[model samples]
Target: MVAPLSAWPWEHLGIFKYILYGPLAAKAWYSWMYEDNILKDLWCIHILLICTLRGLIHQLWSSYNNMFFLTRNRWIKQQGVDFKQIDDEWDWDNFIILQAMLASMASLIFPSLNTLPLWNLKGFIASLLLHVTISEPLYYWAHRFFHKPYLFNHYHSLHHSSPVPHPFTAGHATPLEHLVLCTVIGIPITGSILMGYGSTAMIYGHVLVFDFFRCLGHSNAEVVPHEVFNKLPLLRYFIYTPTYHSLHHTEMETNFCLFMPLFDALGSTLNTKSLELHKKITSNSGKNGRVPDFVFLAHVVDIMSAMHTPFALRSFASTPFCMRMFLLPFWPLTFIIMLVMWGWSKTFLFSFYNLRGRLHQTWVVPRFGFQYFLPFATKGINKHIEEAILRADRLGVKVISLAALNKNEALNGGGTLFVNKHPELKVRVVHGNTLTAAVILNEFSKDVKEVFLTGATSKLGRATALYLCRKRVRVLMLTSSTERFQKILKETPVDCQNYLVQVTKYQAAQNCKTWIVGKWITPWEQSWAPSGTHFHQFVVPPILPIRRDCTYGDLAAMRLPPDVEGLGSCEYTMERGVVHACHAGGVVHQLEGWSHHEVGAIDVDRIDLVWEAALKHGLKPVSSVNN
Candidate 1:
């Protein structure tokens, strides 16, 4: 009779021990004999060595090969990745230490799992095949189970946190989830041992192969050569590329297999976004060379208001019963935390396209109601501004301007918080208040001798009022507090004082030809002005609705003349003649290519500079008399 199949040479001897062991053993012996006594502790030394080597390889792959991988087979047409939020969550050094400790503990508990001198080629191949087949199904179900509402919020959410996954982030899961994954990975090795097909070389080799694929799946960069899939189409069915796994992270609905797309295709759970994104990135589009010109950050007031809703009805309706119960009692705390987190996080709104001048693109980031109230919640507002600046840096935007109350709130050091926290960012933060003052002042012409100005106590309001007074135009200032009005009067120039008229009531300036509403004045109060009056609104969330008879205009930045090279649309109506001065200030800096322009105080000197810049770009006031 023929010998048992297990007695074959190929099944009993492997390359790792028979061929490569001499050099590895010699090095270990030398270290223990002379280099370091610590090497005598074989288990400790081996674990530390393996962890260090793995870390170095991971770092090198992540830093150097990432771009090469992406460019070779890109899935997205983006220039940079936003990993700032992920960095905040995971500390790499701590993670490395923890991983090393865990490996050491595992080796101590199951010493038989340690790498040995046994070599079995047949066993290695069989064990690897078993591991792949068994683990694929086990991982698929476990991954899908984690997506269920009950476990997702508590555990799996951590792994899904990084939308743009990096290689190191593959293992950034919660303790419970990590344990479950480790158990799944061990099933094939255990099975091979029970079937008398396991060897030390096979087990260790399986771990190495498994980790290699795990890192590749989360690399966020596609390295599969285009020719491979084209010439050998069958390989695509067997191998899941980085692009395939990235879709699972982004879409979060499909592509649940660990190693191959077999299970996903079999279950009809594969996502098409991966293929679509790949096609788009590889297509010969005209926008291949274009880059972002500017980035803006703005907040959504409605979303902030919705967060404080009682019972979290929106959140509860979206989750399963288990998560709903888990989230019930913490409603009040959740609301408060949401309120507090507003100052710490930023939400990217959209990108601005077709802007005027050489600068043709811009990005808008919303701070979620940070601009609603001014000066009252100063600390929280400043924190939000700082976060936006850092986010801009992450997006590779070199210059960022605060809009509306953001400019006013951070007027203290001209965004010192951003500058201090992110000194290495190479980004400039501007309040853009100077251009705002300029655009509003430009509204007043020689035809108007007198004007009504509300919100004079505010920074922009006060600056606009003083600018009008300096122009020798009569100014009627309306404010809530008489004491503050008197205090401002003391700082007014003697000649300007002649033009300044203090009034506590809206009716006091009804007869004025022009009215500048620079604060949150109500519709009723705005209606109190004369029927044919011209209203120049400089406040955010403009209090007055557009009227048919009355001409309502906003302070705006002027666009470059059509004759200028690379001129894009100003994205504002020419009927208004100008855009918000704050916006114009940003445009001016973009034109001048200055990366560190600050318009904090909006002093007369800064205002003159912006006014000159606006004129150079062909920006001027519209005819207010016609209104």
Candidate 2:
């Protein structure tokens, strides 16, 4: 029963579907726009806006989340999860050829059949089937050629590396191979459309089906229902089965069918050997199917604790050989913490590892009874800290404990080097070998104003205050415990003036929220906390350099302070809590867009965080900045 090409059923069905739905969608769009009362229109717009905004926010959030997971070493193939048997995967290049052929065909047919005055429904469907048939044989032969020695390594071998199919590995292919495969898909449909028989709907459906089938074959999920296949026995002759595709991924050669199962049988490639190979690969699935949350959490905790410690702060001073071992675990954890912290703070938080002073395996041995005492001492120290914070807050004084800042100063003939680079800016470098009450007072009391301290320490906090009596700055120390504060302050430094104020660590933790409260600071305003007092800000400036096309307006969006009037000095060094050094005159006056002058070759060294010593005491980036 040869039907006329002018009246194919599927083509008529498609036209009907478009005709039926198109007006309904159009009417809905217009009714919301013009026929609406103000309230109705506003409500509809609000709903659409909320949906769109939520999607955008979610997309950004996922990017950060993925980064954190990647950094935390969490993405490593866990023992129980992420099973890859290196045998059951198909080369993605095969799929690329398949998609290219389909895409190419789509490109051709849509323009020709839809536009021509002599367009017929039957011609559109025939053209589509012809595209499908032609691409299959074409891909089969091209795929076989990829196995040849001269071509395989540079061209086809990359896809064969992944023996197991995973969603993430779907698009992995050589660029040249992808182009060749895609061209086959594109040419026929384009040729069809040029012959004045274009149909956009048919092309879209063709691409959609091809992509859907490709994804289905590689998904590694057991989703296809057997009942559907059973009811239609004839389907077995045409559609490629999961088992069929799985076998292709396992074998180095054969099974070149693209859309249909008929080619493998006709080409004499389908056999018991390929089936056995795929089955053998699939048999390696051991019991575990899911990754435990606690494992991930434990790794994260280990990394965060290691990074937050003073040892990681001194990586640069450590030997490269030793530093790598110390830093390996921390890198992933630090990455995850940065991601989590970025979301929590809505600000950038960069984590650097200190490889110097990292504990070696030998340190764990029971030498000088130190290894046995280490945990006891750490627990005892933490307990004492907890007591100090609790005691002080109960009475009324603030307590702050300062730790040693020296990256490397040998203890017991072994010195810990500073592994990470120390910031060149105004970092308060303490000279004391060990932090004690007397050491802190001697070093910082002369200029000390408002002290923002965390943790619990009565001896250190009170002694420093007594020493700072000459300088009248408010003391605001925060800790989780209050009882510990009382015990420490009981032995207060003599002549300590301006009584120490007590605040909860809870309040301190939440301080960032209220810190920006009160009236917004105008350009004319002066510091409200105190003059000449050092404040610790948890803020980190943008680490990645901005695009040269970035202007003062972009800086403002990042919440950076504005430039001084004419000189264009961007004197604002971003900090977490406090605003400090700002750029002075001419700092911001770089040839305005000197960055865009070289479109492709960016001068990476030209970027600088411009801070002014005399003015706003903050820093901003300059395009062609001089350090």
Candidate 3:
């Protein structure tokens, strides 16, 4: 019969006591015996207190004070730890620092046997040296192995999950991987002790040195002096400078050596060459490889894959059983007759006209003209067109009919080549024959807000403005020419003057209250009208400062309060940064090959002002719907 598990005294008296506990206890007892004879009562008491209470008490007190102060203080920002800073305070968020703290605690709690038959000061120092030499090489090789794709995905990917590395990301890896590294330090020290190093000094030296180096390597500050490191002969080989370890964090694959440079030199994985290559590649996108034709095609494939695929077409002869059973009685003959008529119409007349249109309409001059045409005919302009649609989406605008003028503004002439080529851009080619500016404006000006005018603006800009103002639609005119603005103003109605704003020319800023410019506002002295206020925000948010200037008259006329919210709930403030236009040629790539009346930039604020005026006059934002 077997004894009950809990009631078994023999199991409790396991081999652990004889094998592990007895050796450790006997070492401690022997050390205590030497202490009792060599030292008096007070000296023994001091040794006991220093070994047991000093380090633990200090760590505990500091932890409590830091926690208490951080929680209670509202204005005190989190001062993140830096490696270079000797007084760099550690927070619980620093996982590496926490691990080091734990190692320190373990070292303190388990006192080393000071004097033993096998132990000596020389042996203890050697054990400490061996621990660093052995443990660091092991870590370097293991880390390099983890960077291999398969191992990276399983073990090291977690460490790099944070795109912006913070103190918290350090030591954040799989538990199994973490345990493997932690165990390595212990193995080296234990082996040294077995090889006759004094256990007490070996254990204490290992913990203190390991923790110090570990914390220093993980520090954020540039504490390791560059001048000193460059001057140091072979010291850099033994000590991991701050920059050496930082390069590891920045570029993961190559800089695997930690605390020693031997592994890096041996494996030829040192990253100085890789970093220089990275800089060159980033500076010039084409430096690494040629921009392949398939790159854009790959993007298109990604977009298509994200969307659901349509089912394959069914064969003509294989009608489903349900279709045959349900429709055979009366609808079969009816369906066949209708299908034949549709096919006949499509084949004879409709297809002929479609082919004719394709031949005449599908060739147009490129948007930037012939000399500097966008290289990739399909994708270069296409991507910008999609981005334009996205820009419209952000401002709650809708795109409707796009009209392009024929060659020499002739009626019943060939369709505009530009509109015909990219039919997917949604433009309607119009023959601008005998139709007056008023007539064209009266027809399409009802619902359109923005007009992207490409060709010579004979009556296009003025007509669009008149029509939109009559219907209370905001107008944004895009033009490369300034003369077009003068011609439009001459023909525009007196009432329409308030509706149209020219963004390009210098004088237009004085005439139009709401002025826009393609160039950076601050570059030209005249561009800053003493009237309008400037509003600026970061190209990227949060940390970057924003700057803009406005005239007192402009602010007063615009009726904005002195203090207003600029961006993301921040106070409307200005900094001393220059406002430059992003002068990329593909600025409005997506809207190319479209007419002026079809596109415009809408300042939603100006639209709101227009809506307010309409409201004051007791009319809704949409006039036709309200009526």
TM-score list, all predictions: 0.46, 0.35, 0.31
Candidate number with the higher lDDT (1 or 2) = 1
Lowest lDDT 10-mer window, candidate 1? 309-318
| Candidate closest to the true structure, highest TM-score | 1
Estimate the Cα RMSD of every predicted model relative to the unseen true structure. 19.8, 20.8, 27.3
Q: Write the per-residue lDDT of candidate 3 for residues 260-354, one digit (tens) a residue.
A: 87678778877765334333323443222211110000011111111111011111111111223333453454445434633432211000001
Candidate 1 regions off by >4 Å?
A: 1-293, 303-346, 352-366, 374-381, 391-396, 410-426, 486-491, 546-549, 555-580, 618-627
Q: lDDT score of model 3?
A: 0.35
Candidate 1, residues 1-627, lDDT tens digits: the string is 422221222222432323323344465567777865533445555655655565655555454323321242353323223224334333322333444556566666766544443666777766767766787888888888989986787777777876556666775666566656667666776677656666756656666667778777776556665457679877766788777887887777799988888788877888867555544544533233343455544443443232322113312212222222444566676567566645545543232333453333333333445444555666766766676677666656656776665655434455555666666876667767777777677766668899898878777777777777788888888877878777767777886788888888988977875988877777677767778888887776556565666787754545434433322112222222233456567766766677665744457656878778767876554433344
**lDDT at residue 43 of model 2 (Cα atoms):** 26
Q: Which stretches of candidate 3 lie over 4 Å from their true place?
A: 1-120, 163-169, 273-627
Better lDDT candidate (1, 3)? 1
